[model samples]
Target: MGLLVVAALAGACGYTASARYQPSGATPSSGAAHDPTTDPASATAVALSVAAGAATETYRTDIGNATAAFVADIGTLQEAVDGGDIGAAKSDELAAQAQYDTFRQLEGGNAVNASTLDELATEVAPNGSFAGLHAVERDLWTSGNARADVAGLSVQAPVAQYLLSRDRLTPEAIGTTAVSELGWVVSTALPGREERFSHLDAVDIAAAVGAADQAFAAIEPVGRTVDPDLTTSVAQVFSSLEADVGSLGPPTQVPDAAIPTTLRLSVSQQVDATAAELAQLAARLAPLGTAGAPSS
Candidate 1:
């Protein structure tokens, strides 16, 4: 059962959100074209580009691993539940709780990069629509703690519940169902809100943020559910929690009510999407592996 929880965490951490960028006709000019052999600026530019590229790749890989770990943990928890190993499930829950705490600490410790934010704003300024919203969302996740903490919290709790309720379903069945539901939440429900919030005005953003806060507050009870509700209430709570957190002021920003409303909306939407996916994954544990296979 402990092993199963570990697997679910791995799966959650392994879950990957698709990159929002596309190839453009305009490629970055090679340093050779600008004589990197002699021109210091060109040489420096080339070096910086290489470094940036490497960093980006590393970050992407880390994010992917984290996502996979999270999903695996979920799978493990479901298995524990199916096998009726409540003690093991509780142990897994403790492990997940520790990980989530660490994630929050890491997230809170890091500061948002000004240059990254500027770059995101620049990229989105041209699109000024859903594309822009997505750009901001990507940028937000690129910041280490922001993505990790959200994903950690989103995957941990429900899995714990599933494990505690192992008497209700088969391990394989629970695992399969959880993964499938997560896929649906990510592909459909989350993206839908992103599109909707992309069009919000400043006042609208504030209202949405407040509403999300209230909704999140209402969900405190659900967290205690040994057999939780994984319907729209869960989704609503997740959406609200995401929005409330995402609407927080940037690391270095002037205090203006309207400033970054669009960006806030984007962040909120992404968070909401993540939360919804978590709930969906939890709910689907009922139909995982009814046959002879182990929980994937």
Candidate 2:
């Protein structure tokens, strides 16, 4: 998923609602783009495009708010650590982590630069600089409980703002990204890879699920217009997946091993099912001249 920081650029750059969707290897007609009023596909495409645009704006705002709160919490944590208040530092760190979990998807898909988010909340900086949320988590959890270097760890705000400025808010892009994200949640996050230090993998997993659900919501209405049955199936699968994740219970500080194996397996299976349904949804949206087709 770390690669997402770079991969998302393809979806976030140089996109516009007016672009025509031509199938691969097909040449455009001599006339102007197909008229949405007369073409069913074009009409569906336009509607989905508009919905995606609106969803993008909402995401930008939500992520921006989360980033603001996260930065503030980090500052308070730093202050507490410097003041030798370990309890206060731990509490502040939890607050910061929770805020980041709410909008961590922004780190992957909308970041203007690879290092912009990494420098703030990454587990390990490519440059070997051990800073950011994970660094603080490690320090707080360690026996030493010492202060971590929290200088220059607030670039998340500008990254959130970057989403607002970029225009790649299309149904195809969001759907495709959501499918990939859910795959990661099932394979990596639920397996205890994320939030290893803080034992907060449940929080991260739930956040990813929520983000995927929101992505689906953005496209589902148009999907129903295009294919009602497929949309219903997608919604049903999402409901099951959300229920399985909820079974994990609320976010608490518990080691991955402490979580029951049966429940984890159940959630992982449901996640795969949900991603499959979303991929189908994306496929249905592709031919409507609004979204790109999924790659295989």
Q: In candidate 2, what are the lDDT values of residues 122-215, reduced to their tens digit? A: 4344656655666666777774544535554454434554443443445555677688879878776898776657776887688778878877
Cα lDDT for residue 206, candidate 1: 34
Best by TM-score: 2
Q: By lDDT, who's the top model here?
A: 2
Which pairs of residues collide in model 2?
Answer: none
Q: Against the hidden reference, what TM-scores do the models get? A: 0.24, 0.72
Candidate 2 Cα misplacement greater than 4 A, ranges: 1-49, 79-88, 91-95, 98-106, 109-127, 143-148, 155-160, 163-167, 287-296
lDDT agreement of model 2 with the native: 0.62
Q: Stretches of candidate 1 above 4 Å error? A: 1-40, 98-296
Q: What is the lDDT of residue 155 in candidate 2?
A: 48
Give the count of colliding residue pairs in each prediction.
42, 0
lDDT of 1 at 239: 60
